[model samples]
Target: METCSLPRRKLAAPLLALLTTLSLPTPASSAEIHSYTLPQQAYSGSRERHYKVYVPSAMTTPAPMVMALHGCKQTNDDVLNDWGMKAAADRYGFILVAPFITSYDGLRNENCWGFWFEQHIHQGAGEVEDLHQIAQQVDAAYSIDPNRRFITGLSSGGAMSMAAAVAHNDYWAAAAPASGLPYSEDSSSVSLSGQCPGSATFHAVSQVVSDLTGEVDNGYPIPLLLLQNKNDCTVLQTAANNMRDAHLQVFGSGDFKTAATTKASDTSCSPYNQNNYSCHRIAYTQDGTTATRSLVETIFYDGPLTTPNAQDTDHGHYWVGGAEGNNGKWALQIGPSYPDIIWDFFSRHSRNGSQPQGHPVIVLQGDNPLTAELNSAFSDPGATANDLEDGSLNVSADCSAVNTQAAGSYSCLYSATDSDNNSTTATRVVNVVDSNSPVASCQKISASPYAHIGAGRAYVGGVSSLRAYANGDNVDIGGSFDTWSSVALYEGETGKWYSQLPAACSGTGGGFVCQNWNTTNLNHVTAGRAYYGYYTVGGNQYLGSLPGVNSWVKETASGYFQAGQCSN
Candidate 1:
């Protein structure tokens, strides 16, 4: 991540030139906007407050709610008209709430939310309390889905949205703070005057949410989708980065993991840690056992407003341009459609509980064999199963078609089912071949880069040993062909062999010994069972067999490693 330093030179000249040529559009007549005044007592330390609600015609019972807060000098109507959020509400079938902040003497900008004030930012106080009360009022009046409620804001409003999310994580399922600051206690003063204060230190998301929700150990994490403009001058890009890191810390506990990110011509979708969180704590569940999942997504757009005839290099601080008065200001020039992206992220999550399926894990006892000796008795090695929520599971193996008397490749099927009936399958392969002497082929007699085994190895105290091996005539003697050599193990019981272990060999000789070769853990190996070993070199494989000394083997030894039983 390269730091974006504000270009000190030629910054104001280009901005002034761009603003001079800009033309504001006339307000469009909108019938969806409805005005409502909150009771004076609803918000203390503030005068009469008015809020507007936009209920889309397509809204049905129990629809999601989106609270949009406007920036300084921007009105609810400006945000509704300019931000182009109403179309999203109509498309997504969610109720839109836009509130207005009347003039105040100490305000740096006209009609700005008091995001800097401690009372407004604090939980259950001033504007924060007012917003909560208004949400409750809206819930009482309309069929708003309490589990699917959301909030977003631009600039100061963006900062306020962060405050709201942090102070009241219980109310909002997710928050999208567009070009806003993460709420911090150190900054005593906040303004929309284009001069941001120094960056403030913040707590981890887990700690903050736990403190706010009073569930120190098991609090539900509020999902966040932070939107930023690389060229945002009003709210520095650093502020956006700080906010993102802060939220990721909250959701990821300082180890934020990115799940997937897609970059299109005009839009980029970077969803973080997908399918990971089972939001059981905040989920609204009817069965008391099921829960839904949540995710955190972040998006950063490049320079210039997407609107036509807009400046290509300027601070994108305004809502997206389709509003009558926008005049192509404060929009991204080459990035995802902001409104659509926001609605898409908001629609994917809900506190309404939905059961999540947990997949079971299957562990095979033996490795897939590259080759098996003919006329050998085959037995099922079996497997173990475990599930996240269902605990231990019953695993079954079927090797009915294995014919060790003939030389051919075969597969054994293994399946497992959990208590919830969720099942998974694993396959092990076996190869039987005629007794053929392994050819002694050594391209270069150099020390194997990997670990190797010793002949007739002994395990003291009845402990099992796991080993790795690799051999190939073309195996790089210079230690560069680390990926070329491999080993496989054949389970006598299942007649199945597992071949996933890579060879890490060391020792300079035609028969270089390898260690760390076992595919399955030594603990999982069956006691008193003989497991056959096979090594591959340059596409040619050598099977271990007793009384079959060839150029590849100077001594005809046991073709298998016998596991010793340990007394308890």
Candidate 2:
């Protein structure tokens, strides 16, 4: 237990008198508080401790037990009276056990439980062993349920309670550590020296718990409920976040999902981060094959300190109820009732958990491919679905968005539903692209009978010329080939064209052919400047170029001028 050491100040006379009047006990309540002394051999050395149990007079059947621990410099009587545990027990029909820590003059400066010490906290020895024995003793004396045992504490007691729950997890079903630090190897040192950040301390605590409890594929072995104050300066909010993260890491291995989130009403509490005093309520469930249950829950409250010093500043160290000191300045003003929330959560869970319903699984076929050619057909590959409880599910697909006639990417969804109404879905992508190329041919014509004319032929200007034709299987002959075909003569070595047909060729019977040569400005043939004829249609859909043919040379043949003279 750590105490906030602040300068003492004198209180006003009237307020001091009022606090004195409130400190006195009223009449005896319906619940009877019983005191019990532990066996001398139960604890180590002469430093012995006692425990108090709260049992309602109306108790007839076996009831659940909650082991509550107090902070440093606090007694079991203070915890019972100030925290209203007796009243809670009467209302909730449960038993309450509060233990008092004996002061050690030289060993400890404060009357705090030795929760930080290694020997006192571990299994089979120290405080944990003593607490276990006391539980057994209480069970024998009163009707107690073994599966419904729980533990909680504040400050150092809260820290110790966490350690006890971990060491004796087999006995305790759940634990709630409110405004408390985690039990770590460095805890004893930190408590004796000073305090560290909550996250740094809890990281070490997580490692220690992992070492003690062998790592399992499933989530945390025991359910946990964490409570913290947003404005707490002593314990700090980081500690609660770290503790929550640690428990989630231990228990959130499989398909763990957040089930619900509840925000407190603004009228009941102040807003922190736009959330009310009972800031937020988050619940998580781990749906494992063997055991499915709600594993963890957390509540963050926005309020003044549980105990405020003389300066009206809150240290936020105590449990939900205000303690004996500070004149009720640290009492909760707005938020959900703490005792009611705690009992509701605890009562709903037990040691034997329930099985969870599994979700459906959907498997989709690989990506589909299609061509963009006109009138191309498309067929879906389909999908598959399965479930653990619901056998093979009927999978339905929707490919209405797919248009095979257009050239673009498209998507469709495959979905399935189980008997339990659990649904699963998958997406398939359809890629459509153009896969057709245009077919074309060119022929050279010679005016001179001496020139050889064929597909690969060339003749001098004014003596012969060339013509080309093209057609596309997937393209509109009149709109594409007829409107975009052309022919040109270019330098074979340089690839620089000398001239091109001004406009597209006209449409013939089944294809498109180049226009009349006389209607175009064809470059004059020149000697020693090698050139070739080229035909292009539909933006490179089809292209024709000269194939290793030499330009014709001027010559005289049969007493007539000829342009078909070749060296070979």
lDDT (Cα, tens digit) per residue for candidate 2, span 1-568? 1111111124444222212111212113355776665544433532455778777655534677888888776778767765656656765567888887754323553666676576776766677767776676666555677777888877677777777877787788788877666555344332232322222233564574464455222233677777777766666666666555566556555434223221112122211111135456555556522222356666777654422212223355456642111122233313334454465456656565421234455544332332234447777766666554565679989988888778788888888898899787767677776655321222112222122111222222231323221111111111111223333221111111122211221122222222221111012111111121222112221112322223232221111112333222
List runs of model 1 lying over 4 Å from the truth: 1-31, 42-46, 103-105, 185-218, 253-295, 305-314, 321-335, 353-568
Per-residue lDDT over 230-338 for candidate 1, one digit per residue giving the tens place of the 0 to 100 score: 6565665666655544444445432322221211122224211111111111221212223233445556655332223223223345554322123333432123445
By how many angstroms RMSD does model 2 differ from the true structure? Answer: 28.9
TM-score of each: 0.46, 0.48
Name the runs in model 2 displaced over 4 angstroms.
1-29, 42-47, 104-109, 188-209, 212-220, 255-278, 288-293, 306-313, 322-336, 353-568
Residues forming the 10-long window of minimal summed lDDT in candidate 1:
272-281
Task: Estimate every model's Cα lDDT from 0 to 1.
Answer: 0.50, 0.50
State, as a TM-score between 0 and 1, how close model 1 is to the true structure.
0.46
